[model samples]
Target: MSGEMIYPRGSGAYFEQLRALLPRGAAWICEAGTTLGKLLSGLAVELARIDARGIDLIEEADPRTAYELLPDWERVAGLPDTCTGAPETARERQAALHQKLTSTGGQTIAYFIDLAAKAGFLIEIDEHRPAVVGMACDAELYGEAWAFAWTVRVLPFNGTQQGELPVAVAEAGDPVGIPLRGWGALDLECLIGRARPAHTTVLFAYEVEPEPALWFDFTR
Candidate 1:
């Protein structure tokens, strides 16, 4: 008798949850540090199939080129100008400003970094000590659905040797939950769940690949 092919455990479950969370016809934005950024790359491949294209957040030489790399830039540029007024809450005001910035192109990296900081979606994470890293996904891509943002602290450890990076989600500006680990297919699912969207435009302070993965054959 031939043995059945064994794939990574929980990978199927992860994909199922991903499919449920991101249905057909839904749009999504993905950002990653670089080609070797870790779990984001794998997730982007599957997610992109359902129209959740990835954007490269890696810093480039030219600002205009970076601006041009954003997905749906033309549409964002076409949005009506945002109004200047007192919003009911701080979050509202932040959202308003974010809309204005994204709607108009030709933004510099400093602008994005500042915006990400105000929105609590930018931080230092790869340092030697435990530090928070903020991540976000835009709701504009999905036409006004809630945008997701989360702050996670990367635990101090040798990820290269262990083959995993331990992380803990932050709550009320404090770390919570048992530290989750790994950067596998299943690990990406957990990270996504923790960073569930909740705002208008997804405000991320980094860059991601603008192109879809053209080589991986997920199905085997």
Candidate 2:
């Protein structure tokens, strides 16, 4: 087995790779209808990771509000691009968002994560560095809230050393079998809360499969 690849030791690096993988003009959704409070907290964590990674977030209008309240529109109610950060004096706006998300239907959470993904945030909880492993999954899932499309990609803790290896990704369905270049750990827990209940959301996981896999041998 030969080893000749590199990967950053932080979730940010993984997220960067993932952001490049997402569809252009689309974003990773992180909305939690009926759980705006939870959504806010999750956003804070994501933003923290984004900051730590030094990723440039594309600013756009908040779509969740308009999407939820509007008719015949499958848009997101995103926060204002010029909006202030949540940690500062944004409690009032936060409360308002919480209320709006309380009764969101299917696809609401999906839309949010989509926005984050498109804006260069993360879709799943990816962790390479253990320092911020806790930041992978959102806190709202602990409260028995229904989260969907949960996934994450990580170094294989016990991966194979051939031309490729298998790593666990935070995908909801049966684990996707992909190819890797080395032995590393993959965590599938990061993607547990991207969808709403009774709704089918789509997310991806990076694992090890066999034969003709273009995902093999990452450049780090």
Candidate 3:
């Protein structure tokens, strides 16, 4: 509301304070319009400028308002890792930084899902279990390997066309056994892969809907 600065005093304020400290007889050296007075005024201006910039630097130290120090924050977070690529925009980078700072490592399905959500994705986790006699008759039979395997089903991005999702899904669908994948899959695999149980395996799946067919206008 008020167009005023409170912390760093202005150049005129600094000049007055500097003049006040001069000794009684020596005060003439800093009298208005004198050479010494002009020099002192200039020095005060520089000091005031530095003081104002110091407050800005303090603000930059905050992660939420950080711009110049964003790289330092990313380094501390160990970001731009194997999965999440370097953020392409300021907002994107800020979001990634927030995720990195707030996240505590976890192994639960909900944990992984929340991790994906932070990266702007919605996902489902399916834990596989070996077929048992009491299981439903129609349940697909899975072997012991399935016991250690889990699938991360990434739902298509909301409001996106059906065609775009498959490409992202395909890029992200690699099994955890292979080298890590990037992009698509929202860098999710890498985020969770690090926190997943060492004994278990991770897999990715994409859920896409079929596009509607074009109708012919021959009847017209």
TM-scores for all candidates: the values are 0.17, 0.18, 0.71
Q: Which runs in model 1 stand beyond 4 Å of their true positions?
A: 1-98, 101-103, 121-220
Best-first order by lDDT: 3, 2, 1
Question: Against the true structure, whose lDDT is highest?
Answer: 3
Residue 211's lDDT within candidate 2 is 33
Question: What value of lDDT does candidate 1 attain over all alpha carbons?
Answer: 0.35
Query: lDDT of each prediction vs. the true structure?
Result: 0.35, 0.38, 0.76
Distance (Å) between predicted and true CA of 20, model 2? 74
Across 57-148, the per-residue lDDT of candidate 1 in tens digits comes to: 44222223444333343235432222133446534544444565554432334443343344333332211212234423421233212222
> Candidate 3 — which residues are off by over 4 angstroms?
1-9, 131-145, 157-164, 168-183, 210-220
The residue-by-residue lDDT of candidate 3 on 1-220, one tens digit each, is: 3433233358878987887877778546775567877787888889899988898899678777788898888899887788888879877888888877876778887888887877667788999999988999999899989999999888766656234453522336667655343336646777778778999999887666434468668988
Better of 2 and 3 by TM-score: 3
Candidate 3, pairs of clashing residues: none
Where model 2 places Cα greater than 4 Å from the true spot, the runs are 1-86, 91-103, 107-112, 115-120, 124-220
